[model samples]
Target: MNLFGKFATVGGATLLSRVFGFGREMMMASALGVGPVADAFNLAFRFPNLFRRLFAEGAFNAAFIPLFARSLESDGEGGAKRFASEIFSTLFVVLTTLTVLAMIFMPTLVRTIIAPGLAVCVDTVDTGRQAISCETRFDLTVTLSRIMFPYLACMSLMAMVSGILNAFRRFFAAAVAPTLLNIILIAVLLYAHWVGADTVTIGHLMSWGVLAAGVSQLALVVAAMRLAGFSVALGVPRWTQNLKRLLILAGPAALIGGITQINLFVGQAIASFKPGAVSILQYADRPYQLPLGMVGVAIGVVLLPELARALKAGHLREAQHTQNRSLEFALFLTLPAAVALFLIPEPIIRVIYERGAFDPTATPAVASVLGLYALGLPAFVLIKVFSPGFFAREDTKTPMRATLVSAVANTVLSFVLFQFYAEQGIALATTLAGWLNAGLLFLGLWRRGLWEIDRALVKRGALVLLASLAMGALLLVELHLLSDWLVPAAGLHRQLAALAFLVASAMAVYFACTVLFGAVDRSMLMKLAKGRRGRAKAAE
Candidate 1:
């Protein structure tokens, strides 16, 4: 399949996953809200999730996919399969050992790394009343982290399998697997509500649910691998030459990934000092993540292998074309999303999360943070687009160095901003850090002559931004006109109707402006569609 076809397959599945994830977060808000339990749970979950990104999704894939694709190209199917097996065995052993160690030292991890603020007791009153009134529970955080830490092991292995599948252009399974996680979590929340379980019990069950979902995700991807006519067997760890080279490359990539996650970790850790700050930020983050996952992640996952294959075959022009189009595609989707988030954050957050345990008072703070995060959305997506320029060429150290600078900037900025803006300041710090990272990546690529923005891409990006601004202007007016109907107390049906109308209007305006302004190339889209159809027919 062509690049656009692969993107469609992956993006569509990711869109589904994001929708389910939205539902999960909505339920979580009603169940836990921005309460002590919610804060603790978010803290606990962030620990393992951070490592999952570090090992499985970010660094491991960046390092492994290129090498795996090269093995497939140079040594044929058998060589690639053997290589995958060895990597899988090694990753399984390492992740299992790490998970065990993390579980054993969960307290220290929480005290030093996750939530140091929870160590001191405070006479804070429960404002939200979603859970028992208490200070942040350090012991509870540790317990939940230990329960959920195993998820990192399961998901790391699953990510390795996903990288193998992605290398083969089988994007559907890997993209769809995350939806299963949201589904399981939603189901657990529903069950917990049905049984009238307290927030703490619900939290514990949800942590276990994360582990269960990991197993299911791993099983699904393994089934997909099998269906693709590849059997990846588990074996004793081997220190083959290729494996050693992969480790060497992955070391820097892992640091890069860790640095990238540290941006969020810093924000979360600082937010933990205030009761419900973590959950509030989490709720606000969910909306922006939808666009990020749909556009940024889809491009990142599909672009890497495409660029790797092209570069390996000495097809520099094709690789550059792939990179430029990926950027165009990312901006086409992300610009409008960022505009919407920045323009209508309060309405969006209120409509989605300000019900049940999530009180009205929390909406403004979350909305403010969402707006700040909107400023960074483009940078985040750009990072995903540009980083592959380095990774596809097997130069992980450059991005790692860039990330170190960004990470340090984020830490310092968060600390400075927290004293004034509180959680919003932390959110702003993250945004500034994202731009710094993206800028550094762009400069590095330019210096190396690896990527260049052509005239067409620049024109299209400019038009996309203009169209997004136009859409945002329209949304602001429409929202103001529908202010009365948009309130949460106006009844769910009415509020939803107003929100739906505003969203549809914004989308319509954005698409019309882009098409009329020639931002989107009609013929190119038609050609891609036609190519996809022809390929489907040939396969049939």
Candidate 2:
């Protein structure tokens, strides 16, 4: 398949997963609302997920895929498998050790890092109605963190397996494995709601569900690995020269790769000072993540391997083409989505998460946060597009420096902003930090002669922006037209229909505008379609 074909393979699966994720979050909002248990659960889940991203999916994959591709090219399948097994054993040991330590120190992690505000909230006299004691929230977070910490081990191993699959160009299983997490959690939430479980019970069950999903996801990719005629043996961990080199690359990549997570962590920490702020941010996050996951994550996954192979073969022109196309693809999809999110956050949030325990009063606050996050959506995807340019060349330190600068800016801004604007301020800080990071990454590549904006990309980029603005204008008009159906007082079905119509209209308008304005190359799209038809004929 071609690059766009590969992107579709991964992005389509991610779209499925994100759709399921929306279901999961909607259920959580109904069952748990923005209560103390919901807050605790969100924090506990993020704790393990933070580590998973930092150590496994983010840093490990950034450093691993290029080297793994190199192994496959230079060392043959046997040598590549051996290399994978060695790396797998080492990853298994390291993550296991980290999980144990994290579980043991759960309270400290919660008190100091995860949600220190819980401790402080316990001492503050509630001048308002108290749904649950702050003490309970603190203890619940610690308990849930310990219960789910083992998920880190499972997912980290899964990441290594996924890297192996991506290197081999078998993208589907690795891409689809994440859906299990959402599917499992959705099932758990359904059960919890059906049984009429309390918030605390639901939180505990969800934690266990997370652990189960991790195992299921790992099993899936491992099975895929075997089916692909590849296997990694589990043996004693060995410290080889490759391991040392991996550490050197991953050490910096960890921070650089996890910059987005780190920024979220900072926001979570600061948002913790206010009740329900974490869950609010998380709710706002889900809508924007759909586009980011579909476009940014998919492109990043496919682009890195494609770029690495191109550069490895000394095909500099091919590498440049891959980078430019990836950037064009990212902006084309992301800009319009960002526009929609920014323009209609309230309606989106209301439709997705406004029933049951979720108070209608919180809708505006969540919408505001969502809008600020939307402004940074394109920046977030741009980071994904550009970072692979460096990673494919095995340079992690440059992005790491940019990430550190962004991280510091986010931390300082979040701290100052949270004091003033609360959750929205934190959201704003993250957005600014993302743009800063994306700008620096882009500049680094351009200055180092690693990447340049070709004329096609520049032309398409301008058109994409123009089309996005046109879509935004139409969306605002749609919102006005559908105001009656989108209101909080409207029935769920009406709201759903209205939001669906809005989305359909927005997509239609954006596509029409892009095509009319020549933002996309019709000939390239035709080539992709022809390739698909040829593949189908071959299969027949």
Candidate 3:
């Protein structure tokens, strides 16, 4: 399989996971609503997820994959296996210790980092109607965070295994592993909803489900490793030179990840000050995350190892071509999704989440945030494309510096804007931060002579943007034409049908415009498709 083929494999799997994630979110909105329980649960979930992103997905993958791939090239399978086992043992020890410490200090974490707003609410004398006491919410968040903190350990180890798999060019199992998370949560939500459980019971059940999903996801990926004839046995931890070197590289990358998470944490903390804002932002995030995950994540996961191997083999031109193609492909899909989200977030939000206990009032807020988030979608994906330029070369500090600047800007912007625009301000701050991060990463790559946009990429990119705008224009008219069926009074099925039609029409118009405007290279796409088919036939 080719690079884009590998991207499709990962992206297709990611799309499935994102769809299931949407289902899980919809069920969650119905089960908990944008209430105290919802706020608490979302905040708690974000806690472990924040660290998982910081340590495992962010720093670990960035640092591990290049070294692992180099080991494979220089030392063969035997040496690579030893390296993997050494890293695995060391990671296991550190993560286990961190998880225990986090659980032990869960209350402090909740009060300080997770949701200080909840702590403030707990202290304030309520002067308004309160469904649940602030103290109760704070306690619930702490408990839930403790229940799910172990998920970090599970996911961190899973990420190590995933890095190994990606180094081996086996993308499917790792890409598909996330689906187990959504699948497990959906099942738990379904059961809870069927039994008509209260929000508190549902919250507890869901937290447990998250931990279970973490374990299940790890198991699936490890099983994939074994089947691929790649197994790392965890022995006593060692401080080998390679382990020391891995930590040295991962340290800066970890800071970069931490900086990124701090941006998010700041936004979440400020949003927590407003009732239901955290849940509302989360609802809006799901829409944009679909494209980001499918394109950005797939590109990041596939591009890094590919670039690492190419650069290691002194194939500089191949590395540059890979980067260009990855960027072009990312924008081609991401631009249209961003345009749609910006143009018609209300209807999309309504169709997906404006059911059950999800209030109609929250739809406008979610839509507003989603639209702002849409503005940064391309930049977010670009970061994925450009960061690998540095990471694949074992240059982690450059992105770290870039992220630090963005993080500081985001923190300041969120603080200044939140007082006026509320959650929308936070969203705008995040978007601006994303663009800043992307810009810095790109500039770093260009100035360092590591990357450049060839004319073909630039021409095709402008055409893709043009095509996306055309689709957005057509979508506006389509939405107006279908407004009758798309309205809330039209009922769920009618609204759903109308939304689906609009999406399908938008897709048709966009691809048609891309072809008509010569935005995509038809011959290359054809070749890729033919290659895929040939490979399938051979396997059969």
Name the best candidate (by lDDT).
Answer: 2
Model-by-model lDDT, in order?
Answer: 0.87, 0.87, 0.86
* Model number with the top TM-score: 2
Clashing pairs in 1: none
lDDT of 2 by residue, 1-540 (tens): 789888899999889988999999999988877767878888988877876666544466788888887788789998898999899998888888898888899999998999988878844322123456778788889999999989888888888888888888888888788789999999999898789787778889999999999889889999999999999998999999888888888788778767778899889977888888998998898888899888877887788888887887899998999899999999899999899999999988998889888889878999999999999999988998888888888898899899999999999999999989999999999999999999999999999999977999999999999999999999988888889999867899999999999999999999999999999998987898888799899999
Worst 10 residues of 2 by lDDT: 122-131
User: So what's the TM-score on candidate 1?
Assistant: 0.95
lDDT of 3 at 412: 95
Q: Write the per-residue lDDT of candidate 1 for residues 253-351, one digit (tens) a residue.
A: 776755546688889998878888898888988898899878877887888888887888899999989999999999999999999999889888888
Q: Score candidate 1 by lDDT.
A: 0.87
Model 1 CA RMSD to the hidden true structure, in angstroms: 2.2
Where does candidate 3 have its weakest 10-residue lDDT segment?
A: 122-131
Clashing pairs in 3: none
Task: Write the residue-wise lDDT of candidate 3 on 1-540 in tens digits.
Answer: 788888899999999999999999999887776777888888999877876666544467889887887788789999999999999998899989998998999999898888988877844322123457888889899999999999988988998898888778888898888899899999999998789887888889999999999999899999999999989988999889889889878877766645545666789888888878888888888888899889877887888888887887899999989999998899889999999999999999998888788888888999999999999989888887888788887888899899989988998999899999999999999999989999998999999899977988999999999999899999988878888997789999998898889899999999999988989989987897888799899999
